[model samples]
Target: MRSLLMVSAGVAMLGLTAPAAAQNMPAPMHMMPHDGTLLTVVAEGRTTRTPDLATIRAGVTTQAATAAEALAQNSTRMERVLAALRRAGVAERDIQTASIQLNPQYRYQENEPPVITGYQAVNMVSVRFRDVAKSGSILDVLVREGANNINGPSLSLDDPAAALDEARRDAVARAAARAQLYASAAGLSVDRIVSISETMEGAGPQPPMMVSARAQSESADTAIVPGEQDVTVTLTFRFLLK
Candidate 1:
């Protein structure tokens, strides 16, 4: 009986010691340091290329004493313009009607409130030309077909993904070089890249080149110059200092 009691007392003591030992043990450590030196740098890169595609905005405007007359004249001219585009191999899907409007023409005089001079009708369409080389000739055809109010020949790349990727690579390389230079200047070394973020600028379609009414009326084909467009990217890099 005494040995049984002694064994029970020893088990109770062991249980108490186990809990105390567990409480005194150290906590698990975190993998990342709580306080570390970080360096941030921003860099920009650009790539230039001649645009491959062109978007043209063409329209016809007509004025008549009556609204019906104005609309009829405008429609007749617009149909011819559309037919010319179709003959030039511009796909139906590539042609979109931008706007059609009929507004009353008003003559404002200082002495009089307002005077209704006539009615004006306008029809506009946006055309996308996959073959940029032929865009000038096409514009001439449009003008011949009675497209009086013509604008644009906006230049752009059909696929900007490749250019954007190249810009990104350039941006990252520039960022790394800058970071290294700054780290060395601070008497430190770049251990690793903690984070990186990028922003794209000037990657959308470039401003459209304007075509004058006189230029459209000229006998020669419109002179279309697809200038080089710049694709730019900016990168922000966060690097760990060692």
Candidate 2:
């Protein structure tokens, strides 16, 4: 019995000492040193290409005394617009109704409750024109049929792979140029590139700087300029300093 008691006491002491030993152990090592010097740099690149695709939004609106009448009128005008789109070689899938809303019109009165005047229904459709060259004629036809609301002929590149490749090449060149500049300023030389990361920012028609699209409200024939699109790429690179 005395031998068993001594064994139990030794086991208890070992358990207590194990916890204390673990608490005194150092933490695991990290891959990078805390005092290591690193450089952070950003490089930007842009490429311009003519847009090949055009997107537009068109629709009709109607107002009547009753909601049913307003809706019917809106539906008729929208049907006519769709028909016009079909006639212009726009496929069924390319034409889609984007918005349809019906709300009651209100009239304000001095020191009195608001009164309902009429119900207005608005229907908007988004159309994609693969052939951007003939967009003017299409707009004319849509307006003649009953379309009153037209948004834009937003242009874009159909295949942006070539432009993206150009942008990436430029980005790398920019990164290298910046690294060299920093190295020269610090009286060092860039030995090797340790890591490279890239992010794509924008790939669409460039914003209008001097010229804007003419509004359809003033004229039936819409003039579109398939201007240049800007594709941009940004990159970050880590270079080893020597």
Candidate 3:
């Protein structure tokens, strides 16, 4: 009889302690409902400024009876162009050979066979000028120094890291402000930020000079105008519902 009474008391104690343990621990997944709505908010910020760097593609094209002759002529003209660029205050490191090609020119006819006229050689170089005021003058010098083809003079930002950092900060601040507004409207307080993701879209490069315009130059100096470039950042935020 005593053993039976002790067993009953032990079972009673376990029953009381079980409820306390369950209260302290999280409930099982089956007892909970997955009906809570998730809210996502996004914010965007932008900054604009005029580009400071100028990128130009200048090259020399040469035609001769033989491929070797054409290449040699192209090389000489390219050397002269590089020398002129250096004299115009463009650094050696800033100038790079973008392309070099040597191909035989063929004449096409209606019923006759194709004939090889001469070998055509091309040497292209890409140049970056930090000084925008001298961009036109540099092109003028390049043209006089044997640059036959001017493919582009696309302008861009030289140091965008600082601007991008500012834009990111602005985006985060905007996201937080929007999140708070939504949380207040829904009769809930934003407890904490769950996650944040950001996307940055860079500005488009400036327009390139037309090939036709490049081939025919009546003026002594080429004119270039660089406008403002826009930098934007978009941020997505997820906040815990309180």
Candidate 4:
């Protein structure tokens, strides 16, 4: 009987401890629903700025009865042009030889093989000018120094980061404004930003201006107009709906 009483007391003690342990256990977590609605919108922003740098292509074209004569004349003329550019403040690093070519000139007669008349030689160089205002005077000097073939005054900005940043800000603002408009129309509120992405489009240096060679008397300072260039950015934004 005493042994039976001890076992019964032990069973009662175990039943009391079971409820206490159950009360001390952590509660299960409740997960939020993942089926919320997503709203996305795209917006674009653009900014215009004037170019600050110019690139000019200048060269000499010579024709003579012999290849050696043509090449020699072209070389001498190009040397004078390089000296003039240096005197006008163009650095050696900014001048680069773009092309050198020697070809035979052909004269065609009716019902006969083409006759070689003379040899033509061309030597071209590309020059970068940091000062836009000096481009015209430099071209005049180049023409005076025997640059017969002159083309281009390509204009561009040295740095476009600031303009691009401004465009990005404008894009984000436009996206937010459009999102708010949609949210108000649907009687919903934007709770948070889910994601953002960007696309850069139509942002590059302006097209180059072409200048043809003219007679020395007619060749005044080459007029250069550095027009405005556009910087554009597009943004796609996703906002959570509430």
Which tens-of-lDDT digit does each residue in 105-206 have in candidate 1?
999999888989899999999999998888988999899889998889788888888998999999889878876776676566777876677899877778
- Using lDDT as the measure, what is the rank order of every candidate, best first? 1, 4, 3, 2
Clashes of each: 0, 0, 0, 0
lDDT of 2 by residue, 1-242 (tens): 00000011112111223234234322232422232223446677889888888878888889999999999999998899899999889988878888989999999989999999999999988787888888867888887788887777778887888899899999889778876776666666766665677898768644332212234445656667786778899887656555
Q: Which of the two candidates, 2 or 4, achieves a greater lDDT against the reference? A: 4
Could you tell me which residue pairs clash in candidate 1?
Answer: none
Q: Write candidate 3's Cα lDDT for 16-71 as tens digits.
A: 23334335324463432232223356677788878888888889999999999999
Q: For model 4, what is the alpha-carbon lDDT of residue 167?
A: 93
When superposed on Cα atoms, how far off is each prediction in RMSD? 16.3, 14.8, 14.1, 18.5
Candidate 4 lDDT over 1-242, as tens digits, reads 00000011112111223223234322221221133334556678888888888888899999999999999999999999999999999999999999999999999999999999999999999999999887887888888889989878887778888988999999888777866766676666766776677898656656676687784327566667777888899876666555
Residue 130 of model 4, lDDT score: 90
Weakest ten-residue segment in model 2 by summed lDDT: 1-10
Measured by TM-score, how close is model 2 to the native structure?
0.78
True-structure lDDT of candidate 2: 0.70
Q: Which regions of candidate 3 deviate over 4 angstroms?
A: 1-37, 111-113, 203-216
Question: Where does candidate 4 have its weakest 10-residue lDDT segment?
Answer: 1-10
Using all chains and alpha carbons, the TM-scores for the candidates as numbered come to 0.83, 0.78, 0.78, 0.78
